[model samples]
Target chain A: MMHLLKIEWLKIKNYKAFLFISLFFLIGIFATNYIVYSVFHNIVNKSDAALLLSNFNPYDFEHVWQTVSYTSGYLLMLPSLLLIILVTNEYTFRTNRQNIIDGSSREEYANVKMMMALIVAATSTLFVVLTALAFAYSSEKDFSITGFSHVGYFFLKALSYNIIAIFISTLIKRTGFAIGIFFIYMGAENIIAQFLDVLSMKLKSSKNIDFGSLGDYLPMNSSDGLLSFPPTPLKSFTTSSLPTEYTWIVLGFAIFYLVLFSWLSRRLIIKKDL
Target chain B: MNVLSINNISKNYGKVTALQNVSFSVPRGSVFGILGPNGSGKTTLLGIIMDVLKATGGTYKLFDENPDNQLRKRIGTLLETPNFYHYLSAVQNLKITAGIKQRGENDIERVLEIVSLTNRKNSTFSTYSLGMKQRLAIAAALLGDPEVLVLDEPTNGLDPVGIAEIRELIKLLASQGKTIIMASHMLDEVEKVCSHVAILKYGELITFGNVDEIFINDDIVEVASSNIDQLKDALNLMPGNLKVEIKGNIVQITFPVGSANLENVNQFCFEKGIVLSQLQIRKKSLESKFMELTN
Candidate 1:
């Protein structure tokens, strides 16, 4: 297992793009801080929503944990883009073809790269958690921490998204196409669903607000959007998304994606031309 | 013992038949070359043996074990260009393969040295030239020191010197009692290295046999006589029973290579009143032999 890890690390070590993306991920943590801080501080705040958010604490140690949980959806991009390159570039570089020819089974190759993506996911999740903790402490010198129970919830949700990223990257196997699909699933594809919802609303027709269900096919919307419920700032004082059985559905789906993709990637890899 | 046995192995991809009832074997420690034109299923056959592909209708055994047996460790193959993460060094790539094989020995440095990539051990694969990558691929195959090696177009894209270097490496491995199965269209290269050759045409095995036997029996001898008509008649009565073709005054005959001849032929012709003007022996080049088998 350790040997496989070493091999994956060696493989990824030379990609200059991975380094650039990792650094960007680190910077994104700070970027989130700035966005949330500017919203809460009223310094050149232009929107009423921003003013309303002025009293909320994104950096407070108490709220930091909430913000981290809230922003996992945002932090997921780090692993998603990295994974796009990790899995898809193998096909483009023709290295996956060569690796298979050299004697490592395709499933072995897929699993090893998946394992590497898992590490990237684990660490990227860590960055979000650690930075959130740092911001929390910086904001409150005597920030008394509570709600340790939600940490498990945080870990599961974070794990599910990273695995989803790996699965998508593996299935698509093309960096450009995977990343584009990723962006669409994360943000744009749902616009069509939202537009559909709007047409019904203007007609004042009886339609369920639970229409977010359509996003499931889009991957990110059904997934990360599930985590978006139970507004973070409002519930910042007490973690309610935790112990909510409904979150289990989202968590379950994410886990399912990971397992399903793992099995599929393994099956298809052995038969590949390389 | 036959190290490999393929029993009517066939594979089809939906509408296209990639391989059809292809059958052949590699005897232990022999260098077997698979010769074919492009799209002739050379790689496909090798892939089936390695289990990189699932054959549609045939079965193959290696080392007396099934294709999926753990004995796969005893075989190393270079099916195409070497595949590994491009960011990794050659040693690192092999180590990853080592990890997958559950082989714990750290023979990476040694294999690198064998391929002469030790000097560039730290460099990323992207920096290595095409020949270096190929050598690295061969090094990866040799890492486990398996009993057999399968290489598909191993010398493709290499400089002539690089090709010769790899050829020598393969020859050396064969010398060490390893069964090497190489597939290529480069007839001369295969001819020089392979002890046994299998000619594949249109996804079928056109011919398979020991090189010395198949080609050795087809040597050429060019003879000319003053009385060509009488020479033809005399050659027909010869004891060696060589196949003779007359073109004007010159008659070319092919018999078993290195057969004792001409003196006996002269006596027979002299008794038959046929006078010989010229008689000389010649060897058949491998290319000619390949053409005979393939075309």
Candidate 2:
């Protein structure tokens, strides 16, 4: 597996897009957290809302992990886009066939790509951890690991997005088309999840029944649902009427989808002609 | 020992069959040619053997063992076209190929020099001309100097000089006791380089064996006269003529290989009181023989 990964590294080590996207993603993590960090530091601190908030600093050590993970989660799509381009580039260049012709088994080829996805997710998660630590230390608060689980959720979300990117790349086998479909699917899923969330709210209010959030049961949303804005006076005001958060069930669904997509991507490469 | 043994291999694309029950074995140390026209499933068959495409039915073995990645690493192959990372230089691309083959990482420079691309090895693959890209693919396939080579249209995009160079290179490699399986539509190319040949037409294997046996070099004599009928009759009665037939404005006589004598043909027509307008001996071209087999 390590030997296979070395070969994979050789393929992308000189790729301009790989380096460019990686640079943008690293900066995007810090820039996104900085933007959110400033909003609370500048406006919320001086505005009339500060009295109701009672001096809440989201970037403080207590909440920095959740804040950074949730804020950085939106930029997860960048790495996923990178993964899509890398995988689909093999098909675009027809090197996938060449790789196998050079003596790579279909299993080895597919396994290496999956390993790439895992490595990308791990590295992105590591960047998120670093960004959280940077913001937490700068807040001048005592160090704490209280809300670190949000970073773990961020890793799952990263892996979920990346595996889906690889799956779509294998199925679509074109760079622009796979990237387009990925964003389109994300948009379509969000709209449908919104409708389902509204329906779940209605069910809870009128029928006195609880199904948790049906929107969180979806593939992307299950992982997305794992991370949320940390509990605050402002956020609590809007949570009274929302459906209960079934963390365990949503976490289970997220894991199930990961395994399902991994298996599916592997099967497609193994059983089909290159 | 046989290098490759294919058993009843077949491939189908929906209702269209690309290969039908094709079976052949390539002996070691022989230059084997898979001769066929375009769209004749040559690339598809190689693809199946290299495990890039799934066989719809049947199986194949390499080096007298079940095919696997390890077995494939022993045979270098360039199938169909030049496939490489466009953004990478020729040297970089070869590195990836060598890395996959696991035995050619240190031999990149030597292979590039063999293909005469050593000077431009630093240029990106996308910047190469069609001929150069083809050369780079050949260079990659030559990495590690594998004992067997499967080249599909190996000279497809080369200039005349480049083509000649590759042909000479192939002969040189074969002289070194390497087994080469070449897929080409160029009959003359096969005739010049191959010791064994397999002819395929529309996905069916027509004939395969020693090149000498499959392509019997029968001699032909063409004679035309003022009276075509008299020319045909005289050739029929003449001795040593294997077969005689009338073509447009000419009478063609077939004879055993190297037995067609133009002087005898001309003399026979004159003795029959017919003045011959044209009498010429024609060597049986491999193209016509290939057409005869495929058609």
Best model number under lDDT: 2
Q: Per-residue CA lDDT of candidate 2, range A34-133, in tens?
A: 9998999999989999998899998998788898898999999999999999999999999999999999999999999999999999999999999989
Least lDDT summed over 10 consecutive residues: which range in candidate 1 chain B? B96-105
The A-chain TM-scores of all the candidates are 0.74, 0.99
In model 1, which residue pairs have backbone atoms overlapping below 3 Å? A40-A54, A61-A136, A98-B83, A99-B83, B9-B58
Task: Name the lDDT of candidate 1.
Answer: 0.71
What is the TM-score of model 1 when looking only at chain B? Answer: 0.87
* Interface RMSD over true interface Cα atoms for each candidate: 3.5, 0.6
Number of the predicted model whose DockQ against the real structure is largest? 2
Clashing pairs in 2: none
The parts of candidate 2 lying over 4 Å away from their true place are B266-277
